[model samples]
Target: MNEIESYIPHFIVHGRSRIAQCECASCRAQTPFVTNAWSNQVRHSAQIQCDSVSREVLFERDAFKLHTQPSSPGDGEPLSAWQNNVNQSCINFLIVEDLSIEERLHATGVLLSRLSRDDLNESDASTPQSIGDELLTLAVSGVIRQRFSQMPSIDRYKRDYLRRLAKVHLRVTPDPIASLAFNLKLTELQVMSDGFLEDVLREIESSRQVEAFFGKHGHVWTNYFLHRCFHDVFPGAARNAYDVMFLDLCLDLFCLRSLCAFLADSDVELTEESVSALFSAWHRGGKECLGRDDHVDPLLVGYSLITRKDDRYGGCHER
Candidate 1:
């Protein structure tokens, strides 16, 4: 075999081992701190024809650790036992008591805005819909609405309805040319940066060629787990499914993850309405001008989402 051909198997083994270590550490933490980071690692590993290690080993060790943690003296309960005591009904009540549907949609919109493409945001002043504007708007709305369906009071039937609605409008065919162009542009952008994220992005770029399997299996693997992991994060409905699927395709992008972190860490209010109005402007492809009332604060929907998840874990109660 030629030198390049001979090196392929070695590269595959290294990538697979890197992914396994990340996954094992994340699972053992008993929290989702590294969930987003390592998720794409698994898919990239799969793309290189690396076999998936047994995931049964991932969580069971954590479960054992849970029981070993000492009980608090004041309450006479295990420190982590609050999660077991909190029921679905209680979590729903705590989440909805201070927040209305409109507020939830607004927070969801903020998250959607953060997730939108840099290209789309840039074109808002020029030609918007010439790109994939409407597809993203609708997908954000659809995912939010689907998340609400999981609540105890909401009709669970909305899940299937929203899924169908998403599938009907979202026909995301593989776009090899567009994907290649994007990666090429991304390469130009990352090469100029100097930081840890730049290094990670470089590694991902080097592995892109092996991701022929991504085109075939990415939609299933990426979306299924994202939904499962973020099931409780946001709520609302947009007008299209293609937008949602398109965003899903871009989930592993470093810019998107950084934007999510930025928004979540900002000081925006959870019940802000102007955030939704700004999202509406973006949804309309930014053709219309924003009024004085259209101004939105920086978003903290990520913080809000994380707070809610923790609230559910610590025994749901009014904030």
Candidate 2:
């Protein structure tokens, strides 16, 4: 019989080895023997678990084996079938937390392989939107918890996967803007007392420390912070006049000129328009701003505005 097939369980009923021990120099190597025994114990436990899952036809042939089937072209299998197979495999392995790193990696590989560009895009479906989202959360929070417990730097692929997960979460949540705000570490104020906005405003008015902090990070962080504050006040409603005035005050404290620049460049146009027109434009623009890139650069906004202006004016310089 081969060495693997001839393997027997090691037991110590009363601290005795069943096998005969030859007192030679090699036999005296206690460390190696103990290490091998421990290694065998772990492997034996893993194999037993594998045996349980191996009864399933899908896993029986491929549990320990890497999937080498071509997903398209020469293979008759469609991409969706391959995706479903991979998703099922990942879900199964994810349920068993004690699986080896190889098994976890296999699950991760299959999950990643199943994703197409379409899976990353935002979807309005009531379902989870993307299987990759749940798989990623499970893999990180459950299967590989220990690996990321120390908070190591993630590689590019893992970072991209995390970004996709965040996008999906943002889309599915009741308050996507709030979801995004939390992800950006702007959630500190969520724990503050009932008079939170009052406290912030008072602090900003009373101290240079608050001003200095906002000055250092500039409008990118300021915009994010404002979004978090507004979302906390309004939850999901459109911003009203009070919201705009509060934003204007915060901007003015940061710098009056910056506030002026913001109003001028905004869609509201700051003209003698009716209150309804102004509020409508401001609210719509606020929603668009929340969904824009993190940084609030006037130059980039100006470029976009110029393109839009050209389209509206039909290339004519005159109004």
Candidate 3:
């Protein structure tokens, strides 16, 4: 096995002798990697506890390291050690702890009622307004803030988008839904947190103004990109929750490209100092800033990905 594939032992259980099915049209049509016993073990481990067995198989650490989570919300780590770091106070301050059902209902009601304004269109009813004031109360009642915050980019994109949704409605409710969420029982709460994000993204995209706004914003246009990424390339029940996130990143690059285009030809001119400050402010939030900011390019490292490969920023530099 190659070094990278070997590192991801979950995919290649044994060295090479593990049996695998190639029934998937794509897999059958292309070169296949063998799945080892460890893949099954990891799968089994996920059924019970996520980190312990996966760690044992990969030999990263005895305790969990909380690697990248595909659908993870803010503050959910596999290993407690990797969690509880203090770099995120600003974000956390904005993030409220999980509240009881009553709190969630209260918050949801506030958000919904605020969004229900005289300015809304018929389409808003299905999306921004569909989330009834009642559901917020329900969300708060059983919510527990997810445990780890350093999630994979894919998951973070989804969370940031949701957080933005909450923030937009925060005007409606003052207190937002949050960029973070309670670690709810997956068996039940997944429909509320994860499902809700998916639904809102869809409804917004379907609206006439939203579609036009997206068109004007170009790629990486928040709701516009999200709607296309999820519905077009990666639809519901993607390979995993993270799959949705992955496609979002792909679209994010399109966003970066769009940003380059916008800045290169903007009528609004800022001094180089302003550009530099915007860059630094954006980088301070680290990667989280990329997915959320419409004004900032997601390519903060001054790098770009070409052909699924990491390529440093390929755009022309100003003289």
Candidate 4:
């Protein structure tokens, strides 16, 4: 390792222990990333060879997991295997819930490690499913929609969704943040000096304003949610199947831990005419413009394509 190699990981600003140690985009390629927010933020990186042949190199000089039981599969692996199986898993699960289906499919390698029923129904029903796989299953099952039912309180789902959503977007610019504030009617305080938000999800204070706001900023909300998701779940245990793959569900489960939280953390709910507009826009691939209405039910996805959609939100406009 060289002096430059040592400094690559330091460039990764926002991840918890879930952050990986590859130094791929950061060091070798000099990809820019934010560590803090303003003054402290600077560019940093490292690089590793990716085999075009895609071979696995391994050394077995250590006894890593001979005797350890930290409880659930989400507890994580024994040593430094966190990056590949864990971080990517969480990233993929969030992609399905957040970005355009195109982006999700595009980054399929970094995220979107799916598992099948035969994989889940394997001989190990004794353990809980992989959080990643489970989340994909949740997406497929549409179970997340239940949280959006006619709950007495609205903010329950709203705040949780916003909080998680904001973290995932990695939004540090004034324009997008202001745009978010304009749409959501939520306050946009500088949680991180350079317009980065971590601790406090700046939200506006009008429930009635959300419908219109959601219409225009669905992608914005999706970005925030996926960005925040990086912080919500961590490297715990390595999972077996897609259903339990990445501890990804913990964040959504974390979002829905309680009744009020469930109510507060509704799916990014989009309506019929709204979805038609979005689908049309999607079909056009941003070439042409549709109504500025882009919204998702304040939501979550994976497993069976059947279970991935929610019943509470059944209406949509055709493309």
Q: Please list the C-alpha lDDT of all candidates, in the order they appear.
A: 0.25, 0.27, 0.26, 0.28
User: What TM-score would every model get versus the actual structure?
Assistant: 0.20, 0.17, 0.18, 0.27
How would you encode candidate 1's per-residue C-alpha lDDT over 150-244 as one tens digit per residue? 43322122121212221111101124453344333333433343354334333433332213322333222222222222221211122122234
Supply every candidate's count of residue pairs whose N, Cα or C atoms clash at under 3 angstroms. 8, 0, 24, 70
Better of 2 and 3 by lDDT: 2
2 or 4, greater by TM-score = 4
Better of 3 and 4 by lDDT: 4
Q: What is candidate 2's CA lDDT for residue 168?
A: 19
Strongest candidate by TM-score: 4
Model 3, 27: alpha-carbon shift in Å?
48
Candidate achieving higher TM-score, 3 or 4: 4
| Candidate 4: residue 317 lDDT (0-100) | 10
Worst 10 residues of 1 by lDDT: 36-45
Ranking by TM-score: 4, 1, 3, 2
Q: Which stretches of candidate 4 lie over 4 Å from their true place?
A: 1-79, 97-129, 147-206, 230-319
Q: How far is 166's C-alpha from truth in model 1 (Å)?
A: 36
lDDT digits (tens) for residues 8-115 of candidate 2: 122111112311232322234321122112211111111111111111211122222221211212212222333233334433433343433223333333343334
lDDT value for candidate 1?
A: 0.25
Q: How far is candidate 4 from the true structure (C-alpha RMSD, Å)?
A: 17.7
Give lDDT tens digits, candidate 3, residues 21-123.
3232223443343222221111111110111221122222111212221221222222121111111111121122433211221232233233434464533
